[model samples]
Each structure stands twice: as structure tokens, then as C-alpha cells.
Target: MQIQGLHHAQITIPKGREQEGRQFYCELLGLEEMEKPEALKGRGGFWLHAGNLQVHVGTEDGDARSATKAHLAYEVTGLEAWKETLRAQGLVPEESVPVPGMERFEFRDPFGNRVELLEVTEDPSL
Candidate 1:
């Protein structure tokens, strides 16, 4: 068997700072917060759902450092709209990454997690 697609992307947040997550992921990013399972209810953090894609923010030791090398990439339809939303929240896209066949940019979450928004265009050879 082979893997079909990515299930979720787990990001880290400082302990007891889940409300920040709600503000950023839910309020700003427009992701819906889902209830944690019964078994995992005691654990810290929250779950966000964008359609079928999931983003899990878990609590961790407080650190000044932010995620640099690792990041999550999301496929989006309204790229310009998303950028405007990010700017409206004062979380402007850091820099637009140049990919030959794609339009994309990177932005940091409130907790300092890097997320890439991508828009793929049709291939010439159809």
C-alpha cells in the first residue's frame, strides 16, 4: 500500500498559550477549531480544520526560537485574497518564493510557525 496524501501538520506552541492559537488559526486564518478526542482531551493544544486538511497545534516547552527550516505548505485558490487577509491581520507574507509553475509565499503564524501558500497553474502539455 502507498500513502494517499498528507493527513495533518503538527505545529508547536508554548504551553498554556492555546488562546493565541485560537486567535491566529481561528480568528485570523479562518480555520475551524475541532474538539479533541476523549482520550486526548486532557492534553494541551487545539485542532484546526480547513476543509479536510487538519492542523494540530501542540504545547511544548517555551522557547524564544521559532521554526525556521521546517514549514507547512497549503494549496489555495484565492491567492491574492489570502495575501490581503494576512495583511489585514498584520501578518504579511514574508517573501514570495519563486517556483517556475507555481505562485507562493511564506507567512509566520502568531506562534512563529512558517506556512506556505501555493497556487498551482495548469500544465502546458495537457
Candidate 2:
């Protein structure tokens, strides 16, 4: 199975500064704010459209961006096949927080950066 492309990349801002994050990314950068999933609404963060992909801005207590839970999400065609592939490579994939219409897992890369593989089961925007 092949990865289709990047679905989204995440970055984090300091906790309780969501409004500043929105003003910077949405107003200054001109990215349209996208609705976060209903289940995730209470989580203090936001999502933005960046051309064909998305950028998810989350909150963190303190640290450099990479030290937080920021990650890159890649869209893949085969959900189960990817799990098998990662397992064969000896990497344990951790189940992600459930998002409606998507199946996903996260694993740390060799250098310790978080990477997520996701397959869309339905159009989440619908």
C-alpha cells in the first residue's frame, strides 16, 4: 500500500492562547479555519486549511514545538496493510484518539518525531 499524501501537520501554541493562534494562522496567514470534530471541540485547539492539506494547531504547556505532541499525519490507502507493514519493521503503533470517519495510529520515527498514518473511512466534513 502507498501513502496518498500529507493529510495534515500539527503545531502547538502555549496553553490558553488559542485566540492568538487563531489570529495568527487564520487572520494573518490567511488560512481558513476549519471546524474541529464535535468530539474534539472541547480540546483547546483549532484546525486550518492550507491549500489541499490541513494544519492542526494544538495546545501545550511549555516546550519547543517538537517537544510537544505536534505531529505529521499522512493519508494512506490501506489501513490494515499499513499496520502490518509497520509491525514488520518492528515499530509498535499506538492507537490514536478516535476521530469520526478515520482510522489512525501514531508511532515515533527513528529520530523520535511523532508520525501518524491515517485512512479515511468516510468524509469527515460531510
Q: Name the best candidate (by lDDT).
A: 1
| Number of the predicted model whose TM-score against the real structure is largest | 1
**Could you give candidate 2's per-residue lDDT for residues 1-126 as a string of tens digits?**
999997887776777888876765566335799999999988889998876998887777755554647677767778788778768767678999999899999876433446788889998779
Tell me the number of clashing residue pairs for each predicted model: 0, 0
The TM-scores of all predictions, comma-separated, are 0.83, 0.51
- Model 1 ranges off by over 4 Å: 64-67, 123-125
The Cα error of candidate 2 at residue 4, in Å, is 0.9
lDDT of each: 0.82, 0.75
**Which residue pairs in candidate 2 have backbone atoms (N, alpha carbon, C) closer than 3 angstroms, thus clashing?**
none
Which pairs, if any, clash in model 1? none
Q: What TM-score does model 2 achieve against the real structure? A: 0.51
